[model samples]
Target: MTIPALEQIHRHASVRHYTPEPVSDDLLERIVRAAQAASTSSNLQSWSVVAVRNEATRQHLAELCGGQRHVAAAPLFLAFCADRARLDRACQLAGLSQDASTLESFLVSALDAVIAAQNAALAAESLGLGICYIGGIRNRPLEVIDLLKLPAKVFPIVGMTIGWPARPLRQRPRLPLHSVLHHETYHPIRDEDLLAYDQTMRATGIYKDPEKGWLARSAQRVQNPERPHLAEAIRQQGFALK
Candidate 1:
């Protein structure tokens, strides 16, 4: 029986281990088409996705993602790029001035790419395929642009790994509703709510580390040396997020 949509969404966990079964081109095409069908900013559709299937390319991308083996082992790897070059070219070809230089336009394309990538990720999960986002893809943005042959005004926002999951998984727990949800006005979260959430997460058994609390894990991530220098990396990749 198919699981409920809300349950599936809330139960999602980043799957790192995958089976040997390969994802077929036809299935991958459908996922891409579904991703394109997602809503876009002013219908500019300023995003591009590259599916990396070759072992060598995947290995290189895996290294870019801090040597995450799943990026190299997954049957399908997708790099989602925020692209303004197409619209700029179209404007120039039509003898019109392109307004793609603004920070707003850059943000729009970045948001659009993220939305499209999530659409594809959810669709793949719904089909029993496991997927994980490779945020480390941004660690070396200029190198990724060179590896992918991306044009000017195009930036790789993130990468994804997709394939059949190899093992039974535990669902990642989330913060309590009160911690995230608010009434019409944004209500400031209370200290009690934060403590309650930490306790709830501790009980979930999803996070195996002995940290025992959400705050500790979050703090560790913030202090992690492996985290990329995101702003400078994006700037180097031609995104002037001014």
Candidate 2:
């Protein structure tokens, strides 16, 4: 019963290795247009994307993104930003006061950015392009902002690298349906479900050690003390987040 679109979705894998072939300007524009076609909260469309094609800029950004080489190697890198600057300007032009400093406003803008990015990613994948989300950009938000020349009321949500794949990648294993799907009310995940998912992940052989499964790896990531200072960075970027 799986449709072609669903099959593509299920086959998605993060592509870190890319070929030297460049993505054409027209294709990049089309992909971005598809992103703009995504649903926006209240039709405000409070998001912006900065396309980085320069090798020097991409290298600097790659370093800022915790030395992720794929960012520098990709044909194109896009920085999706949760933007309120345009809305604020619109309010000013209408002789109205702007109040986009609240936490709710920030959340809405960030959500819009995420939705747009997904749409763009799907469009790229449909066109036989590869994409990888680079969340490490958040590790040095101020540096990214300075490098991109982002104004106040605009905060980078995430960065994505897109290009032609160097080689095919296998789909990563995911948790079972029952572990995440809850009908009517929230249900606590059973330990057995987690163990089963861990086994599946181990069997995939992606990790160096099969014994260190998804649960342990995920828990380690969650407990990592080297988390990004996103809240402080957001505050500095003029988001009150109240």
Error of 2 at 238 (Å): 1.0
| True-structure Cα RMSD, model 1 | 2.2
lDDT to native, each model: 0.86, 0.92
| lDDT, candidate 1, 8-36, per-residue tens | 78768889999979999988998899899
Model 1 alpha-carbon drift over 4 Å, by segment: 1-4, 223-228
Give the worst 10-residue stretch by lDDT in candidate 1. 224-233
Backbone clashes in model 2: 0
Q: Against the hidden reference, what TM-scores do the models get?
A: 0.91, 0.96
